[model samples]
Target: MACDREVRRAVSGLSGADAKVYELIESMESAGIVAVPELCEAVKASTITFVGFSCTFGDDGERSIDIGRHGFFERKTRSRTENLLSKLRDLEKDVRFTVFIDDMEFRRVWGWSRSQESLTEECEFQIELAREESQIPGDWDVELWSRVESRIECIPKVCLNTELWHQINSGVACAPINYEMVLKWAAEPAQSRALDEIARMRQTYPRNRNVKLSELRASSVTGLAVYSHAGEVLEFLHPGAIFIHSADHRRDHMLGYRRTKPLPIIHPWR
Candidate 1:
């Protein structure tokens, strides 16, 4: 109830289309109201595990938006950490494996920094710490956090070896990373030319359609470099890391879409 009140207060301050949407969201919470088309599509669409990443680097080689800027962050971190917590809870229960992709603007919009932990890392630690300190009985908090964290298997756009990267790039017309899908996810559609450009690229380098999830291996990431909207990199000192890259480098390097199989092994850290 307290959280609801706070959310109401926040929504009340929104104006224009934002306000209307939030109003509907509030209705959804209070009366189970929802936009019919979207609800219907969501209900009808085949469920798949999808993970998204924007570029971490700007055109100027600086840091871009960080985990704090994500919609799931509610324009602030820690204060709205519950939003992410809840998302992970859902992801664990529903998703099996996720497909990761990066955008070209990743480098153009935000530069990379060697510092700062990725949002995923932040989420992992925060949940783990919260569980350890929780007063809840049966250590349910820990179970919840563990349940969500263990299932995650992250893959990078760039392969660990340049040979694999070349192998993928040589056969595909376009770089295989699905930038179009990422843009659509953000409610931003690319121009037709841009779409065609990728299509042509894909045509020139037609990809092998038979790759299997089990054939892929997860990359060993040392640290996740987080980009900040303020145009800087945020650094975190942690052992486990998740790395992401952009597809804009497709013309110069190999970037391919690869499926993932849920590993029988859990995250060793958890």
Candidate 2:
């Protein structure tokens, strides 16, 4: 079989070690062991991609059977390669290959002639379960599993009076209204005293409670009321603490009133 057009183009510019590597892959392509169109195109474009290839050398440094990795290619491709490698090893030839993605290499098969009894056994089992026609195992309930493992509840809304809301909106307290801003403020060493004050206030009024913003401003322990208010604002805006609306109308009224209904539960997997 002729090597694919893309495969030839992919190795057209290479020399030395890189050229040797692709030559081994081309042999596998010609043998109908694996199709390399996607892999070849990625190489030709110099884009990052994953592929596995191996070369075996004799004691006299003669190169022998070269093959691609299992799992990356289709079942038939893997099966053919495995069978070919097995037959080659039966003749006492060394067979080995390394799996790689771009510059990173992994799971190198060294001394394959002496490693194991069967090459395709474990691969076949895994491929069968991964096939589109295969049914999920009976022991697993996907729906219940999702509900238990993948759900995130909405945070309760906080209520603030008009004056306190204006104070925050006017930027007098430099309140953080988003998760990233909260993280930035929290990381500052200068904000430590304000964070301590906020922590003390949390002990008295849990985060989920509908507390007035005025309470945070008045409860300053370090006498820096502005910093205390800003720190409290960051706590409210922390991830998993509250959902901040992007719309102007909703954002305008965010601290004005408490929401009567709970926000919808999030299913991250979906």
Candidate 3:
């Protein structure tokens, strides 16, 4: 009964083809003329219904069954109907759901939905680009150093007496400079204390990192320089970006950077 209530709530919000499929499932459950337990259960699991129905009974092409039409019930036998229900149930547990849906029998069904093909193609293109970029000499290290040099040239030079800077200059190797550590060595005590507070605030609210970093840059008079063993630190820098000088003992060590698209915002209700 709880599952039925959930199914009813889900059905109330759905529209277009998804709503129609659930409507048919609701009709079958209430009719009591046939025992379609699998269909009834599928309706109760909203995610299962949302993903399975469009994947299994897509509305495209000549062979596609029009569940929207009243004649569909008359055309399909009880056994055939049960077989389709069983297939939908089995699909929920299948590890290769994508492969199964791409099969000829189900491929047409996804016509109304977003094309998984485009996503696959975009992923493949990025992989290819990475592979090609890796073959270039010095990889992204040269580019990172060039950017760092350019930024440093534009900013005023202030002597850094921090232990981290000493470790880097002495070639003893040191951890990459982070926001919290970077502010402790600020030239002016007042600016240093303010930056430290911003860093603390960043810990409580992560989205504020960029804003805090911007404030640090606007108020600071010196370039922030630090050493890293790898170039991956660029990914973490926010507001004004920084290039970290990195070196490794291995002769064949290659460093690279891959720019990724920003993640989509997810809504809690969805």
* Weakest 10 consecutive residues of candidate 3 by summed lDDT: 261-270
Which residue segments of model 1 deviate by more than 4 Å? 1-35, 41-71, 74-108, 113-175, 178-270
Better of 2 and 3 by lDDT: 2
List lDDT for all candidates, in order.
0.27, 0.31, 0.30
Give the best candidate by TM-score: 1
Q: What is the clash tally of candidate 3?
A: 1
Per-candidate count of clashing residue pairs (backbone under 3 Å): 25, 1, 1
Model 1, 85-113: lDDT tens digits are: 23433533222222121232233223344
- Tell me the tens digit of each residue's lDDT in model 2 across 1-270: 355665566557565544543444445443132223433332233222222211212232322221222222334544454454454345443444222111001112132342222323332343344343332222211121112111211221223233434543442433323333333434466555554545445446566256655454333322232223222432333211211111111112222222222221111110
Residue 85 deviation, candidate 1, in Å?
11
Residue 27 in candidate 1 has what lDDT? 38
Clashes in model 2: which pairs? 54-97
Highest-scoring model, lDDT: 2
User: Which of candidates 1 and 3 is the stronger one according to lDDT?
Assistant: 3
Candidate 3 off by > 4 Å? 1-142, 150-187, 205-270
- TM-score between candidate 1 and the true structure: 0.23
Over 3-64, each residue of candidate 3 has an lDDT whose tens digit, in order, gives 56754665576655445544544443321211123333333444431111111233444233
